[model samples]
Target: MIPSAMSATPQSRIEIDPAVVTAAGDFVVPEPLGFGRCLAPVVFLADYQDGQWGRGRLLPYGPLGLDPAAKVLHYAQVVFEGLKAYHVGGSRPMLFRPEMNWRRMNRSAARMMMPALPRDLFMDGLLAVTACSEPYIPRASGRSLYLRPALFATQPTLDPAPSTTFTFMVVASPSEALASGPLRVVVERTGARAVAGGTGDVKVSGNYGAALHATAVAAQSGFDQPLWLDAISHRYIEELSVMNFFAVVDGALHTPELNGTILPGVTRDSILALARLEGLRVHERLMDVDELLQMIRSGRCTEAFACGTAIIVGSIGLIGEHDGRLCPLPEPEGPHAGRLRERLLGIQEGREPDPFAWTHTVAPLDTSAPDRNG
Candidate 1:
């Protein structure tokens, strides 16, 4: 069951466009909702200026009037987060651990030298957009309402310092889990995703751009994603292009520790907590790519997979080096990975008990009147 929202004063001003509501009412999710390919018809928006944030609103989904000289355009002052809302079998629509994303977003904002959003404002914006978009949330297992909250520098200036103004928006998409089955991964020996003491732990805009080339190159070679190595010593495995790396070695789960370079993913943390509750031994350590490959060859490492908000849990079928050499995992179906994914899906879709209290229920919105504001 979905948990109730916290008793915070709603600061979001709602203004639903008739067209947006009609569009959502008339919309039917395509058979294949691939990742973020389908966007909801409405969005949540707010602004920060004069050293404070303004009131938030639920408005029609559309393009923004970003100036050509906007600070985000030139200086790349941006941070964002990805979370999901689930509504399956006509059950209560709910969000999964959104507070984590809120906390993580503020952490990124702090590192980017941006102002923090008030808790009420964040909650209001998230709930308002999600409530309005509830009609579009997919009701199938592995499908959800993917929510994206982003902050961008809006002030136009040539100064190198942080901008005085910023824009915060929450957009949603009705979609299925990104990627499917096992993934073919390519090891990236060159270039680093993040340095030792950089903005690697946060979901800033620049981090994805830095790893695009590697991912693009990997795709050309028939790989789903790139396996990023550590910045200083390229031997240790850090993470994937979008997800955290995990390997099942000797009946235990081994993942790279959060060493200030890997994004602290909500999905990754959930897996760690759930795995421990199941009495499974989980090790968070620096995994050497070379040693892991040898373990795979020796049959010690039976399975490996990647986990994130979008991908959830994707098994790694094969891992290859830059020289085009590929090594296949014996059990790509991932006996442990499959079990963990089931446990996760159960909790997410309301089929299993949620002991950790991660799911948050969203109240159904009354969109009967287009002019109604809340």
Candidate 2:
């Protein structure tokens, strides 16, 4: 429901209707909340046509009437981003590295041959939605308001070209972290998440749907996710199905280098920066899966974790290969991953001093809501 306090200031290009805000107030988030399950009652929608983005507005969240032949429907010409808003023990919620998400989203849009979203629209839309949906952001330390910004081709055509018209929308879900504990991942040798000179580096919609088959297979085989290898060699570790991978090898953080196939994740970058700042050795190199398994077996690799917007940092409990081989980490929740998660969460949740200034505060629509607890 639209909160009355969500009215856009005169300086804002985006519009927030009073009626929409009023309707939003009626929504009540249900209990037993899980990640990405409970959505805010409203969303921000902007359209691009005639080679220009239109004035956007907040609307009640609902289904869209897309054409059957829309470019996004047929050709999957769409890209999206995921970020979060935290209730950082204040009346207002804080956004963690939103600018990074905005920049990455534009990168994805560029890769998909879509027009870049203006920074004003992106920031304003995120601020507007997060401000309006502030009450729904869970107060729990590990929970947050998950924000998703997506752009898709809306042009109704069968031609195999980028659509001239596009739709940009921002929707939010209030829930806990995607993964709560250590995960068991399988090594996927058959399929690749992204290929060289492909859309793997961007957050394209097809990139996720393309990996669903491997995820399904992994799940059936009792794995949480699939660790995709390099598309060419199928030996070097590229990334997990959705998150970037890391391992604590010999008291050092080792992750796969950005080899044109890995999504340069904001959390992954933050972890690296934090690790290096703490005087821990960090390496970004071509990590071979076989070698990593051997290292785990030999106790050279003490821990492994996956990082992303949704999962934050998930410890890798076990790594399974295709031929019934399982390599278990000596300590799944080792100090390295635990400390990183703690520090990252502390910064994001406003518990610790933000030395890096990664958090952005968003004023709440209604100040009456109680301050978030530590």
TM-scores for all candidates: the values are 0.95, 0.94
Pairs of colliding residues, candidate 2 = 1-23, 1-24, 1-25, 2-21, 2-24
Off by over 4 Å in 1: 1-19, 368-374
> In candidate 1, what residue range of length 10 has the lowest lDDT sum?
3-12
Q: Model 1 residue 167 lDDT?
A: 93
CA deviation > 4 Å runs, candidate 2: 1-11, 365-374
lDDT tens readout by residue for model 1, 199-307: 9999999999989999999999999999999988899999997899999999999999999999999999999999999999999999999999999999999999999
Evaluated at residue 206, the lDDT of candidate 2 is 94
Among these predicted structures, which one has the highest TM-score? 1
